[model samples]
Target: MDDDDDLTLNLFTPAIKKNVGKSLENVIWGNRQQRIKARKLLKLTARAKPTKTPTLSESQSDVYTEKSEIANNKKRKIADVSLDFDNNKRRNDGSGNVSSTPTKKLKDSLHFSSLFNSNPEIPTIDVKPVECIKEEVFSSDSFESLSLDTYMLRNLRETMKFNQMTHVQEQAIPPILNGSDALVKSQTGSGKTLAYAIPIIHALQAVRPKICRGDGVFAIVILPTRELALQSYEVFRALVKPYQWIVPGCTIGGEKRKAEKARVRKGINVLLGTPGRLADHVIHTKSLHLFKLRYLIIDEADRLFEMGFEKDVKLIIDCIKEKTLKKQTVLLSATLTNGVERLAGMSLESPVRIDVSQDETTCAVTPKIDLHINTRDNSNECSAFSVPDKLKQLFVVTPCKLRLVSLVALIADKCVLAFKKSKMIVFLSTQDSVEFLHKLFSNLFKENDSVSCMNALLSDQQQDIRKSKCLVTFYKLHGNMDQKDRTLTFTKFSTCKNGILLCTDIAARGLHLNNIQWIVQYTTPGDAKEYIHRVGRTARAGAQGNSLLFLMPSETEYVKTLSNMKINMKEIMMRNVLHNLLLLFEKLPKILENDRRPPRTYEEAATTLQIYIEKVVNDEPEMQEVAKKAFQSFVRCYSTYPKHLKSIFHIKYLHLGHLAKSFGLRDAPGGFSAGKNPIQSKKKHFYKQHPCLEIHNPKEYVKKPLSSFYEFASGH
Candidate 1:
């Protein structure tokens, strides 16, 4: 072997074995060429590079250091904009572990672009000059009573049935009526709306002599959700009926914007809605004015500030404050958290802080220091819990897979007491969960007609619900649905005699749906505060309601955390069988074929949303413009977009590669194919061995796969 061959001979010995008589150098060169070609091929094919074990730590670190941002699009200057309407400051408020620091230029560009893209055909919205008429103030004359006129007093007593004033009403109403800014922290469902509502109505009545416009709003009440907005609007609607001059208008997302504008043009005395939709009008349209805004109520004030509405709400407050110096600001929330004290200082002038929450203080000392109890005060008075006194809260400890079966069983059991009006609100943590649970329930109850009482009310007739005469109703509500569809779903669920609403936390706050017999926490809330709100959905206004919280062995700790709120959660003794649950799901093959079919893959849901968007824009051309305003939120609803959805959705991210990585590749593979049922292939029946019984428990309850954890309830 020559000098070059001798040195390189060992390298090619493995390679030379395959091709005998080949020179060592030649063999080494050929293998190197093949490797180069293979690398080129891989790059061309766009395959992920295989990561190797670290020869040194720095070499391994380099693999992860270069983060590709696929969101930045050079094609458009209006790219990667997190618009004012969509950007909730809380998400990017630097409170999270990751970077929420959005680009300043992107936010500005997005806001302007959306505003600029609004229909030019919409008339130059002009805010009618609101005249603040001065009269004998109610506070000065008689602050002792509600300080409302005789007619108003009668309405408050007779219509609202307010016999004795709530502590929140007593403390908050006086300062507000006297033209003072008030920061109120009251319990949920404590008539906080009335404390502000009664005073605002009274103040408006004082200005009755002034010329009023039917097309503009005088007072704007901002809430976190459309459901809450609707509830507050109802309070105003019913209160203002006595004064025919007072017109209340609701302007929230999920309702027709054009229709809302028309209502504004018709002149509304009070505008109750979410920050985003209201800001959409204030900035993008001139259809409304705050020139005479006497009362500005920020209900769920902490939520408005915390859940990323700080920018929108602050923008609103700025717009109103600029127009009217005398606007009385009222901020009401359960907790004045997330720097809300700072907000109160900024917006409210010498505001009276009303904290009527009667919960007992927990000891900060260690358990052994005080037996984990506060005994020093020696007061026997049990503090009021955040969960209402009327609410019967139950914790159903079960596996996630068993939750659906448990829900069905509970419904069957409770249907009798509901008296033909079994209204349930099943709260899930994610939109995907909401959609899945809705499909599962719909499948189980396909034969039971009129599930969606909304067919007659909704613009879409695809469900054909109007024709059905049966009672059991089912509906789904989440952020993804078209606003119009969402509104219809909310209305249908609100009005239905026996309806089931499968929803996310989106429907948790301020939704005052009557006869809500149960609030099923299909998925445990993220924390104790969320649990409070979920359970708060029922037992509202002195009505009896039940809340079922599903818990896994790991999740039982959350129940322990509810100690701060003193929530009485009774653990339910589940009397269920697996066979009964499987049996309840009758004729799945036929139902799967008949009801179009449940989403067999992640792509299916994304594709469905894409089609939904297309159909909405196609059916109504004007909606295309509105859709642009909400473009970011729309894409974010389904973050993992496949090629079909990605192309159809057309999202512009700030860093394309980072977004791609954060979400996922567009061409990800599907789940099991539609035709393949992983279960037994027996097509005729669910099971021949276990003859279907009237038994409601799960069919395979006895099949103890995770049976060890099933005993978790005993420990609790």
Candidate 2:
């Protein structure tokens, strides 16, 4: 029954009240959507109550009006946030002009004094528009033209012997010297190191007194690989050595952490190191400080981001500046990827992008990378473009088993007979191949009497640079070997006038070994970029060279992909493709027919694919999320084949496919589901009900101490 009706009936009679209360059960609220939880019945007083009116003071009226204005300002501030979002979206999209009229009145009325006077906890943040790059830039020619200091010019002319400037150097140096963030893209070995190094040297000289051999680093240059970091450190050392006080340091993997920490703590003015090792010191050890850091140069920037060092890089960037410090960031790379662009957006503030490595002018992938993909499908699709004019490409198509023999005969015809005491580097895809080929060549030299590749350099003018003249025909190098062994092999290879160095991709970068007449590819590399670096090892510094790729018949399909990208290779036969050298095919050993496809078990195929995926993960951590996409892309071409392309690849049961499921790529089979990730709630632990731990002490710890040590000792 309704309470109001029951009260009305109670004022009448008991008999009538029961009937009225039962009838009131059908009564409804004002609206269906709105329901009252409690209803009260009003009663008519017998006598009228006295009425009173109260008046407020003048101060009370003023305070009430002030509170009203603050509430209105809060409403206005909210409107500004939305307006800014819309304006930023339009600006980013390049849709059209944005009218600042929407925010003009609110910004004009903005008064920090009013907001802060009412509430002290509220903060004031200045909203800044997105910064954009300048339209034009200037370039410098010689050291004299750059307006560098006297000492720097002296070093440039006398010590470095640098007379003329390269295109990238002339253009990139001026802006960087002016303390503006810069993004530079140029080809490998295009004097990119010197371009950045000159400006860094100039800046360090200006801040020389402040730079000491203790406390924190002033400048940091991050690289992708350990070898590159070490190489960069060498360049930095040369520049810093002339100036005694300006010390430079390096921290990379494969070093003692305790030593690195001590070095960083002692102080370094300019630092060069790998991202992973640098990140460890800054974050975990807390030894390396970037407090006074003014310059940050990210060399090989594209690879650094691709190798999934973004998180670590950003963490280090955050530690550089607290509020007012402005860090000048410089990014350099051969090819600018989308990741590099995104990195610019995040870190670089209105950076000047100086791109000198245009395809027509610079040829970043110069003497272009020779690519050859051998898909099972016969359908050929490719990009049509001409190869680099200077590069001479030759090929030897052979079965799986005959490759070793073909290499021997080709070397005999090309290097020994035609060009005596010529330098060559054979790039194999794996260490195993390098080891196997080194042995195969040795055996064939003994077996064949007419042709000899051994001890051919004994009579040559250039003796082995090493103390011992072993008279070996070739030296082997790969990552599996110790650092000491690798360095020895590289030194021997670089100095030798006529010898072969069989190695993998470890020799592909930073180590400039000129006078390399030929590059023999044992197999196609993993990708187009890899192909460039591999072939790029040769034809360097404007030198004319030849690259011969040894491919299986099916692998020739990769040519179309390369051709599409303007990397057209001229196919030459095994019989003296270099018109100068005559073929020694007749004297070569008889070849035995072997299986056309690679012989691998299901487990072997899966394991190999897994290893490749792991390598990719080191460069791309986000791939772990979309692993299923990667798997589907690989397996799509092989799905239709009946024997699964001669059992070389086990597509359905790939190890990558199994690993993908763990990274939220798919649901487990048989109705198994992944557990929900634990998410902490936003409700903060407030001290409204709970007493503070500091204030509330336990009774046990409140006990009094003994009067003296002697009494305690006696009691015990």
Candidate 3:
């Protein structure tokens, strides 16, 4: 053959054609060969024997035996010292022993140990047995018997419709009317506001010359939150309707500063405000004349300190004291703490201690049946903190994965399926959880064609249909909401006949809502004391109410902790809740139309409900994002438990994957390193070396003035 013909034959041959496409295969094959070679190197190093035998001392033998035992028991492979890069340098001695560096040894030790080796030990709370105080009977004395002004009595009876005096009012009013500084301690919803309000109104009205709008402020009421302040202001306004000369005004953080300043300039007879705003007015508003301030009332005294308002309260008190010498300071709280006493010492002088909760007449009226007999060491404080006589406390032990489903089931059982109207408050741990759950449930229970069809199927009568259609309105309130939004939510939820309020601890304090049938602690409070206040929201003013607490298996021990503190509660199985929920769903097929087949068991019900929720979350990216943020915030909040509760609520014991499921997430998000405290995560530090390069105005980065850049670079 010719030379050119031989070349063409070689190119067209099957072997040559196969070789043409082998370049890509060769690269992949080379990677596999390198991986195999690396594995072999590791095996060789693991099995490598020392060149020379070194005599082992007795201590060294003991250490080796202990390490071997640990390896065997833990089923962990001991790190091979020969595989370490530093082993060769350490083995340069005549003795051919491989020694690991300190860091390597530490790493191996940590690898063999549990991730949370430093978990705190469970703390034992020393709960003192408190003597039960007898319940005080309501006084038969009417508003007329209190020696209040005629106009005030008419307003109370006709306008406010407050005729009968509660035990607190009977005890606290007489002392304050006698012009003595008073410190009153009573359980919530016991007419404490009226007890102080009536006396202050009477004192203001009895002034020789009638008080007018131009008289400036006379009575100052300071509460912990803007909502509470607004509530008190409304009460004052209603009571002063008959006595038109006594004008009532309110100033809070979220309102228009110009309006508040104008009101102060025009002169307010009675002022109701939160500490921060009150103090701000005292400092800035020149027209706010406290010289004639006759009464200074601090409601929710313990809460003021708990909310870090000590400085503001002190500033207001100092300003008031400097302005007036005849001021009567009154402090009222549900539970009297040392903080209250300290506040009294600083603000009140020779105050009359009026504790109607401990009064014999009060205790004799109601037998000590539902008293929470947990007392602190303070002798001056009430011996026992009492819940309402009619409040029914219940708790449910549920797994983390079923928390959200169980909560939905419980709410449905109480609000929708029940015969009577219901009002509920579901308290979560973080604001993010409250916000996310509020939006999620609102969507779930929104009025739709399906809901309309289900309502028709459930009820044949028009009235019943109307009731069912209007039932289960959802509202959310948290600290992060705007002031106007918070006030609007409070008003809407208060007026709602059958509704659920999803909130954080912000609602657990001094706000009162009429006919709240149930209080659901979706997440237990970090402090045990907060449990009392949370349940206190319902069963106010001698009304019947119920409360439910949701707990995980890891948190069941909290029941015992609460029991030790004299908080009575009963546990309900999670299966029964799921079963009840399934029954409810059987009637309303439209709610769960994806599952045509009826759930035969509670397990099936739980699975179906979880699947529905997860599908909803997965279909909406916004919901998924919210779920992630809520889950992360919940973990951070859980990690911030009080030191005494660290053992029971240890974040290490939390199943993040299962907890994520409750938030409608399929798997836990990453970035949570083991043994790292989420609450105390390290913050990013910014260096000032390149000040000019740091983008101060992100929107106008390119338009930054050169002069400003030069000044910043020169450290001006």
Please report the TM-score between candidate 1 and the true structure: 0.55
- Which runs in model 2 stand beyond 4 Å of their true positions? 1-140, 208-210, 321-324, 359-389, 413-420, 439-473, 577-716
Candidate 2 local lDDT, 285-334, one digit each (tens): 66666667878888877565545576667766666655228788888876
Error of 1 at 294 (Å): 1.8
The lDDT leader among the candidates is: 3
Task: Flag regions of model 1 displaced more than 4 Å.
Answer: 1-145, 160-164, 214-216, 255-259, 359-385, 416-421, 448-471, 576-716
Tell me which of candidates 1 and 2 scores higher on lDDT. 1
Each candidate's number of clashing pairs is 37, 9, 5
Q: What's the true lDDT of residue 3 in model 1?
A: 31
Please give the lDDT score for candidate 2.
Answer: 0.51
TM-score of 3: 0.72
Model 1 lDDT on a 0 to 1 scale = 0.53
Worst 10 residues of 3 by lDDT: 707-716
- Full candidate order by lDDT, most accurate first: 3, 1, 2
lDDT, model 2, position 698: 34
Best by TM-score: 3
TM-score, one value per model:
0.55, 0.54, 0.72
Clashes of 2: 9
